[model samples]
Target: MRGPVSEGDWRGVVRDVRVTGHRVTKRATHGRDKLLREVAWLKALPPKAVGYFPRVLEVRTGEGWAEYDMDFCPWPDMSRVLVDGTLTVDEAISGTRSLLGFAFDVLYADHHRPAPEDFFHVSYVDKFWRRASAGRGMSERFDRLCSAEQLDIHGRVYPSAASLMRELQRDTVLLARLRPPCLGRFHGDFKYDNVLFEPATGRFLLLDPRGSTVTGDSDSDYMEDLAKLRTCTRGLYDLVRAGAARVSEGEGRISWEWASWAGPALQRFSALDAWLVDELSVKARARRDADWRVRLDVLMPLLLLANAPFQLAPVNPRTEDIALVLHATGVRLLAEALELHGTRDLGVSP
Candidate 1:
């Protein structure tokens, strides 16, 4: 018998997750397509050489939704570990090394050379403007905040959240130079949220991957994965998502604060990222990949810009306050990223 059709809203749950014997079933009630993507990516495993990732058991698609089941992993994901302070610095580093080993040793490949040169311009820059424009047209509040040239967030002045990206895009040639030196089959959304680490056995599992890479349906820049991880670490994404943030509007400006938190979790994450940056920087220079590091720098914040617009959408009023924090985070980081490369202003409109 057919069940009652869903409006696609989960009310609160993205899936109806349950454990049946040794298997875990994730029946999608929202964002079903996302689950489908995960299923497809997971089904195409990277072998057992690098240890664990979810093993897709079965996938089911319906009239307007999808669901899948996989091996049960009782361990906490990196996000929960970060919040609970369970994941230690050593574990973080070790787990990441193992993950990257898999990527480097197995996933690295040559599907395309040097990308399209306009990869960033097309993938990130265009999508950012399109999302922001549509988002601003959704609400006057979003319109005002998104339309502003400069914003004072946490008492710090930043260029508009979406504008700096446009500024970077103003000079297409420069955007063309932002490609990472190495291209490979990538875990498009590689971040803490997608990683599950078990401290006891020292085994980690990655769940939920984008169906394909950013630049294509097959391969992508390796730095894209690194940038996504940096978003959680140096970008304080986990901190901000944990409600360790404040946002308010007044005096014709919006203010967003990545407020204080007690503990070593955030600090530990920052350290991990710092280590990654230092290590990668040396190798980038050795390869004479002038744009490699800069591309990574730019990608870190472009990731935020890629998703910030969804927060601005009027779909759920509950996520409204989060919009500003996301906006400011991207803007501030984009400015800093551009500065690191000595990238000059392209005279993009305020």
Candidate 2:
């Protein structure tokens, strides 16, 4: 049982109760009957569809509040397992894929709504560039936080925010197009922490659906979104690789500089990446095409480069090392994109 769940100013509680040989959870809230009603609606889904979620048993409306009963599961949330270092990379990926697949399935099956555009279009690559471009002042905010020990990792020093932003922007670009074709539904918040993996059976159970959104639209838009998402996924993979590298090189303790910047940056990046995956999964299940997939393959590296900096704390270093990595990665991604799509004049756009 959880809550007092709050919606704006209203708050309430969820209690666990057993009724008629079935375990159920109940929610009580004040001045927000709609939320309770939504929960009830969520609970009332058919057992098979609702089984992935909690089943709604009953709903009660009162003078100033509403309450509903729902089925309950006893397993621990995947987030707990992750923080404890109990999950393997393969397990994380499998669990993430399954949860996303289930989210897509449920949204279409239950609500008849299509996926949302921002879900697919946004990427860590985009975020990375945005933050990096903010320059020294922005990076300094995170830097000060680090110097105070408010942030810590294995001990590696962080790159300055300005450096990271420059690196990101030098690597990527964003293109806008119409939405993609509908393939299926999506579980809107797919991530490592939200998926439960049973170690014994290697089975995954998805938890959390509060952020799910569905929108049925055109194929072009969908493809564009998917491309961005794939890019985000690749970025996340690179981050994991970078983190692991730091861990291995530091002999179990990450540098304080690296830890401060990377820790918060990675956490935020992962969340954005998970959201992108959920968006892409929904599009992929509904429509299939080889070209879109190929484009994504090309874009992934570019996006990865763009978003790499926001995930680290700034470290004071020689100009050459910073400039070299940034320019190299940027040029590589840009060259690859041009090779695939043809060279366009590089100048500031009006």
Candidate 3:
């Protein structure tokens, strides 16, 4: 069996070998060295964690072509499950709860260990800055869009995107001084696409751990993975899949018209938010640190903002749509985060 190429350019292929009784994948890219680096990183995971990832079997490389073979696991992609709406609320909570526990057991278990030199450095604001700098200023772009669209920010109306952008950045700067309660190895990319749930075993498996960042090190921010999960729950991916986000060519302009869906999306995240609060609260209690909740509260918006530009890269024609929805979602989340001022409500309704 062969699986379609996963959603991006330069992604590898997934294949199952029935006769050989194993699964395999072959990834090719313009740079063999880069592919090799990813393979090396995957191979370095602890033996127990290796079962969660595709097992490496063989490797071959040449100029401009790097290919590797790996044993595959047959599991339906969660993104497809989300798009199909086949997942029950119980299933969603179960998967997420299991993931949180598993991630804690795997990545957070050794928080004190010195980080590897090759660990990726995650620049929290780099994506927002990059997209914000491109085309027109981010504020100006959003201003024009807001003029055409009605955005109700907690019953207040913004005359332009400039105002909203100002608020978003203001909160971001204030959040910069905060530190995570804990940091350690994380599934650098912990979005739905990289996740799979096996109904039989009731286990969640992750794929494609980012081996390196542009700066040639690991992005050791554990909050990033959690933030990415929240972003998905906030409907960034759903909006893209539902055709609610549209992007214009050449200018890279993006817009999202799914106003009615925003509330429900946040509602869907309510359970997860509460779970996170509870989990963090337990940690804070153990350490006698009340600020743990605040750290998480402020960190959410910043991470969301960082994700805005992530989808804006020129990977497809819908680049603008991806950017627009992610940017708007991040901005909305940022506003909610700011309004609460690190309070427990967290803008996720009861």
Best by lDDT: 1
- Spell out the clash pairs found in candidate 1: none
Query: Best-fitting candidate, measured by TM-score?
Result: 1
lDDT of 1 by residue, 76-172 (tens): 8788787667778888777777766665555554334566665666667665665565565555565666677777665666677656765676655
Name the lDDT of candidate 2.
0.40
Kindly list the per-residue Cα lDDT of model 3 for residues 229-249, writing each as its tens digit: 655665356546455554442
For model 3, give the 10-residue run with minimal summed lDDT. Answer: 1-10
The per-residue C-alpha lDDT of model 1 at residue 111 equals 31
Candidate 2's residue-wise lDDT over 101-218, tens digit each?
5544554443333434543333333444443444224344333332232112233333333333333344333222212233333333333444556765656655443321212121
Error of 2 at 324 (Å): 26
lDDT of 1: 0.67
How do the candidates rank by TM-score, highest first?
A: 1, 3, 2
Q: Residue 258 lDDT in model 3?
A: 49
| Candidate 1: regions farther than 4 A off | 1-16, 29-34, 46-51, 109-113, 137-141, 213-216, 251-263, 282-289, 312-318, 346-350
